[model samples]
Target: MRFLAGLFALLAAFFPGAAPAQVVDGAVPGRAAAASVTDPENILVLDLSTGGRVRIWLRPDVAPKMVERVKTLARQRFYDGLAFHRVIDGFMAQGGDPKGDGTGGSPLPDLPAEFNYLPHVRGAVSAARAEAENSANSQFFIVFQPRFALDKKYTVFGRVIDGMQYVDAIERGEPPASPSRILRAYVLADNPPPYVAQPSLPLPAPASTLLPLPTGPAAATPKSAPSPKPVRRAARKATRR
Candidate 1:
């Protein structure tokens, strides 16, 4: 239990938002939702193109920089129409790329890592960065499964307080064949502008781009073989004789 005590102290010092509650009679305390009942401003509303609505609660106490970055971008309408370019089924849904491919972000400079001890439990929201520790820009992901390995690695700044179903339903693929997108996103505290669905990117060419096959009976009928040239009448008569 000494290890647990030290771990709790470490977490409390750096991640006040996720300080583990004291275990009482083998039962854990209630969720943060119960504690956040009076603080609706911390919740963000994300509306997707498929008419799905998601509510996520920000945790500035644990990842102040990341939470601020996200709120800044959301208020500017930066995530509107951005595709979930990288989604792994049973794992996560990632987005915030302006390119709709996983390669773009806002013109703003990248943010320094704000790695925290927040647990990557299902519905946890964290920044998406490249190999470099401080490369996180506008991209972020929402986990659909517990990912303890990600703890203390990614910047966990929020958790989905509502609409996990929508997050679960987001299209899945490294780059989903038909990726879903954020129709609009806004911080509940910022008096976010009204959401307007953005146009979807042009679809890829069909798997088989071959021209449509000719239809109707005329196309089906094989032309009769050209009539054999009439054998010379003289040759025919000689053979008969």
Candidate 2:
């Protein structure tokens, strides 16, 4: 093992910009100098029904085919309304199963695993597949914590850059009592409105306690100073006091 480590270190020293080999089950090859998505335009935004949003910047360099698949699916609005069917706190939040039962995917064919050296660190977005190595499809999962065991096992195509707090707050359950959903999804490159999840207004207090809507012009009219009472000439009475 020491010899192998030394060999890897030597290779890295020879190759500029090479990622250091991570010592997992064994010394795995490091990330190569490949083009990655360094712009915000390659991001995917998930507007959740829970009023939370997560932004993930896609890494085309690590998994080009998978990233393209994700972009195509997002453009088709394929992920909208999908429930996080399988969520394990401290692990990951899995979704994109159209069936919402962890047993479905896009009608399109499955993806061959694009496993790379990308580590499954917090907020890593990876493809979820069946028992088969090449069964990955539309379904994917977002890591909430570092999971080195999953490194190179799943296709790591993206990572959460903003709104990871929301991902961390995802309901924890294999199938949450009420699964949160992707209310809508779109590519950031499309220049979509930035998602800002705000707390729902307190149900308008209770209709009974709420003020009634003003009627007609009364609602539209702006208030003004009352007219002066014509300087009520103190009734010049008092017989010219």
Candidate 3:
């Protein structure tokens, strides 16, 4: 376990502009220490449809507005039953869209970019946005492999501190024929309700029903990238919009 931890530390050391807040001494890789969460309010807990709970340590220090947006949505139970609409093997799982299609976001206004020094290492949670840097709303994704190319290009508001195995278990596809989902999301400080298995919602509306894509110099049709390698390669490209 220490070997795995040391490898992550080394990766951080070699990666330019990696955030220092999460690289703690004696930290285990994949399974971050639960005690690392000093403030429960900063912990975002997801009870996944895949079964088991995943805890992400929200980093307001680097991406305050993005974190606030996430917390606000969770408090509203806005994420309950949302499908992991886009999951790429060895890449990331993208979700939090109300329309269950990549083009949708919450009714809330879009937020300006809060890009920071946080590296897109495994377990990193970043906001999904349109080409316009300020277009991120309720959509976000969790990194399953280190994606250095994504660093500073996306707003990383949190990192999975535990239950990554469950994240790893998320079904893989642009839209998995049997996609996994978030049963519920909560701010740990609020003592949200426990997980209970719920019947799946009808499959997401077909692509033909997708909302109009955002329009601007930054806008592009949202599409899931192809599968990527485990390390040091420019993984498949996706708009994450």
Candidate 4:
């Protein structure tokens, strides 16, 4: 049985969150309900182009301001049709940039950093910012694997408790050639419309102009093209010494 044990270990390393848990119709089973969110206001729902819905339990206790920002944007329907602009396999999927080019945010003011003790485990939802910590605005990302090193570095405001399988299906690329999108976003308390599959539409070319960081936060350095070095470093830390 040594061979079988070794195979299982390999699988566990590659799919750390793949423990067999019951899922029904893309929702986590009731057994996880004890830890799952029930309060409608604390839940953020995304109807994704990858198909089906993703339910996130917002953590106001640790990151109240970030939670409030996300809820406010969702109520405005600001996230609908926004591309999953930056998706790295085995890392995370980032979107909510109106530019669809990793360089945009809502007209709303940038938020102060809400960094907390939350670990960046699989399905953790965190806000994305430029070099400046307090520059996070409408952009956010969802972790595909555990990334503990990012715990206190980014503002993690939520965790996905359901429909993660759909999240796993998001196309992988810095900007996916055919990027998945948020068809709709809702605060569960609002009684938003049911999920309806949207027809595929061509995304407009991204604009070259980058908006200056909002007035309150420290000036943000312009974001350069994404590099693989950070992902490589994170992988080595997770796998090697």
Q: How well does each candidate superpose onto the true structure, as a TM-score?
A: 0.66, 0.68, 0.72, 0.71
Q: After best superposition, candidate 3 residue 22: deviation in angstroms?
A: 16
- The models' CA-based lDDT, in order, is 0.65, 0.66, 0.74, 0.74
lDDT of 1 at 147: 69
Q: How many pairs of residues collide in each model?
A: 0, 0, 0, 0
RMSD in angstroms between candidate 2 and the native structure over all alpha carbons: 25.3
- Estimate the overall C-alpha local distance difference test score of candidate 3: 0.74
The digit string of per-residue lDDT tens for model 1 on 125-145 reads 988765456767787888877
Q: What is candidate 3's lDDT per residue for 1-241, written digit by digit as tens?
A: 9998897788788984573544557554454343346589999999998878999999877788888989999999999998888776777788887777666777788888888878888999998876566777888888877777667778988999899999999988767888788989999999877767676565485321111222332232333333323311211112333
Candidate 4 — which pairs collide?
A: none
Which ten residues in a row are the worst by lDDT in model 1? 205-214
Residue 128 local lDDT, model 3:
82
Q: Which candidate leads the pack in TM-score?
A: 3
Each prediction's RMSD to truth: 22.1, 25.3, 10.7, 12.6
Pick out the ten consecutive residues of candidate 4 with the lowest summed lDDT: 232-241
Q: For model 1, which pairs clash?
A: none
lDDT of 4 by residue, 1-241 (tens): 9998788788878998765665775555543222237889999999999889999999887788888989999999999898887776777788887777665778887788888878878899988876556777888889887776666778888999999998999988756788898999999999988889997555544422221211222222332335645533222111110
